[model samples]
Target: MRFIIQRDHLVQSVQDVMKAVTSRTTIPILTGIKMVVSDEGVTLTGSDSDVSIESFIPKEEDDKEIVDIKQTGAIVLQAKFFSEMVKKLPSDTVEIEVQNHLQTVIRSGNSEFNLIGLDADEYPHLPQVEEENIFKIPTDLLKAMIRQTSFAVSTSETRPILTGVNWKIENNELNCIATDSHRLALRKAKVEIDSAAHYNVVIPGKSLNELSKILADNNELIDIVITENQILFKAKHLLFFSRLLEGNYPDTSRLIPTESKTDVVLQTKEFLQAIDRASLLAREGRNNVVKLSTLEDKIVEISSNTPEVGKVVEEIKALSVEGEELKISFSAKYMMDALKALEGTEIKVSFTGAMRPFIIQPINDDSILQLILPVRTY
Candidate 1:
């Protein structure tokens, strides 16, 4: 196998595929990257059994050559060393040639290195997912959706399903929900797809986060295909595959409160800043709890006190505080995370009671919703 490729493109492609490679895999060959040189282009693949990524660099695009293929063949090289070597190669182009006995030589700008390559045939084949049930979403919206909800996934493995974000698409509406049991984030968006499209899947939060890091923030649509056990995301010159979680995601709809006992409208920024300041003292507390109480004339007080540390108290004026007066204690970190995820100037915080879960949502927009269970401080 021999190919001369542009250095910049090679570096970028290597970085993207490296996200899927891991050193702790049971299959030894999975530690290396599989490279296939063909007549059409060069394909690089990396996988850790759970997640796999593939990048294809065409021989030429728009009459400009990207890869000059000398011989059609395949090789597997150690991912860690090969990636670092390609990044630091001192040349505009790098030439890679596989010699007898699986010996691979890399050369660029008077720098030459030989690496013992593994046979590409030893690499496990990626799952073959049919593209019949396909859905499309814009890259930027997908990234935003991941950012807004992935954080809420449970880190604990006791209930494995909660470690992933539940994705449900039906009637052209996409709804994503993630929760660690203490807090929940829900994001909704309209997808342009065939009316008959329907799917319910659980995608690992870690995989989504890694995918988000590699996706370009653009209006380009990403084609998604779902099967019985795997989900494939196809982008320009890239293909990402992730194994679906095995269990059915818990029903989260019943968890959201339908009615509010008290509702307060406040500027999102001011509330976030007040919570941030109050958390300084709360951080020293075991639960990191901050208290919020409604006062007369639409004033809300934010306070936190730790015995070892001084207390913090601040008051912020709300646009309107209606219904019964409320006092709720919750983790400051949870509140701040929810506030940052919400998109808008003004937000409505609804409380069912001092002991029940409360919701924070952007005023007049139902696309995003956040729920935090109040911490018991009694």
Candidate 2:
């Protein structure tokens, strides 16, 4: 295999694929990057069994030659060394050639390095998801959904299913929900689909986070395909595949309370800042719990106390406080996370009781909702 390619393009492709490459992979070949040069373009692939990413660089784009291929072939090179070498290459162009016995030479402006290559055939194949159950969503919206929900996935693998975000699609509306048994985040978006496909899948939170970082922020629609065990995200010049977790995600619909005992509307920023300040001392406590007590005339007192640290109390006037007055305690970090995920100036927090899980959502926008379980401080 031999190719002379634009260095920047190669570097970007390498970085994108490297998100899937890991030194900890059990398969020896999975640690290296597989590169294939064809008549159309050069393709780079990386995988760790759980996630696989492939990036393509066209030979010529818009009448400009981006890669000049001398011989169409394939090779796999050590991803760690190859990625670092490509970035530090002195020239704008890089030439790669392979000789007998899988010996590879990489050359740039005054520097040349020899690397041992592996046969590309040994690399595992990424799943070929059928296009039958495909949907399209705007890239920017997809990223927002990921950011809003992925953070709530359980970090503990005790209940392995909760470590992923549950995606349920019906009637062209996609609902994403994640929870760690303490806090839950839900985001809904409408997508275009090819069929009346009803898909309930659990996607690993790590995979979605990685995909969010790699995808460009754009309004263009990206194709998504879901099968029984794998999901594919197809973007321009990129293919991302993630294996679905092999278990039924717990039914979380019943977890959201239907009735409210106390409902308070407050400025999102003010509430968030109060929690941030109150958390300063709450962090020293065992549970990092901050207390919220409803006061007269649409005001709420935010306070926290730690015997060793100190106590903090602040009053924030809400837009309106309805229903019954109540006091509740919850994790300060969880409230801050929910507030950051919302996009609005005002928010409505509905509390069923002092001990029940409360719901926080942006006022007038029902597409996103966050729920936090209260902590007990008796």
Candidate 3:
């Protein structure tokens, strides 16, 4: 393949695809980025088995030539070296050409480098997902949903299913839930769909994170296609495909408590900061547990103690406190994560009891909920 392309566009495309490229991939070709030059444009593809990303750059856009293709062909170049070389190229235009014996040459300004390229035919093909079940969501809302729930996915691989976020669509509403047995995050949104399509799938949290990072924060629509074992996200000129995690995700609906023993309303910022400060001491001890105790006159005492380290206690006046008195201990990190995800001026925390899981949600918004299992402090 031979093409002279704009340097800036080339760099952006390479960077976007690089998120899927990994040196640890067992397949040698998977570690490289595949570049295909055609009459329409230049397409760059990168895959690491679990996730695949393809970016296309048109030959000419808006009457300006972005790529001048001399020959229509394809080559797989080592992503590690190629990405670095493209970034350091001294000119605004980049020239790439391939010759016999899989030899590739890249030239820009006064610098030129020769790289050994692999036959693109050996690379594993991206999953061919037919347009069967498809849905669309706003880019900004999708990103927000990912941010609110992906963080709650388990980082451990022991329970592979828990490492992904569970997605369920019914009644034109999409519900996403993630939990690591200790803390859980759930977000629901209404979607536009023609058929009454109901789907329950678990998508890798890592894949969602990378996809969200690439998506722009706008109201533009993103097409989502779901197959048996793969899910495809189409955004403008990019196509992202991720393998779905096998096995049924545990039913988490039963985990949410129905009755509450105590319900307290507090300022989100104040509560988050108190937990942040209290966690400093908890971090020196065990699982970063912070304690919250309800006091008279609507005061909530947040404290943490470690025998070896100093203790911290802060009193924050609640907007209102009702029901039974409560004292609960939970992971400060988890609590802070939920609070940050639910960004609002006021929040209502409902405690089932001192031992049972408690929920933290915005006062006015019921679409998002965060639950944290209390830790026992003897």
lDDT of each: 0.94, 0.95, 0.94
lDDT of 2 by residue, 36-63 (tens): 9999989999999999999999999889
lDDT of 3 by residue, 1-378 (tens): 788999999999999999999999889899899998999999999999999999999999999999999998999999999999999999999999998948999999999999999999888889999997789999999999999999999999999999999999998899999999999999999987756798999999999999998888899999999888999999988999999999999999999998898999999999999999999988988689999999999999999888887899999999999999888899999999999999689999999988899999999898999999998876
- Evaluate residue 140 in candidate 1 and report its C-alpha lDDT on the 0 to 100 scale: 95
lDDT, model 2, position 273: 98
* Candidate 3 segments exceeding 4 Å error: none
Across residues 1-378, which tens digit of lDDT does each residue of candidate 1 receive? 899999998999999999999999999998899999999989999999999999999999899999999998999999999999999999999999999959999999999999999999888999999888778899999999999999999999999999999999999999999999999999999987788978899999999999999999898999999898899999999999999998989999998999999999999999999999999988877888999999998999999999887999999999999999888899999999999988899999999999999899999988999999998888
Which stretch of 10 consecutive residues in model 1 shows the poorest summed lDDT? 280-289
TM values, all candidates: 0.98, 0.98, 0.98
Can you give the lDDT of residue 187 in candidate 2? 99
The number of clashing residue pairs in model 3 is: 0
Per-residue lDDT of 253 in model 2: 92
lDDT of 2 at 29: 100
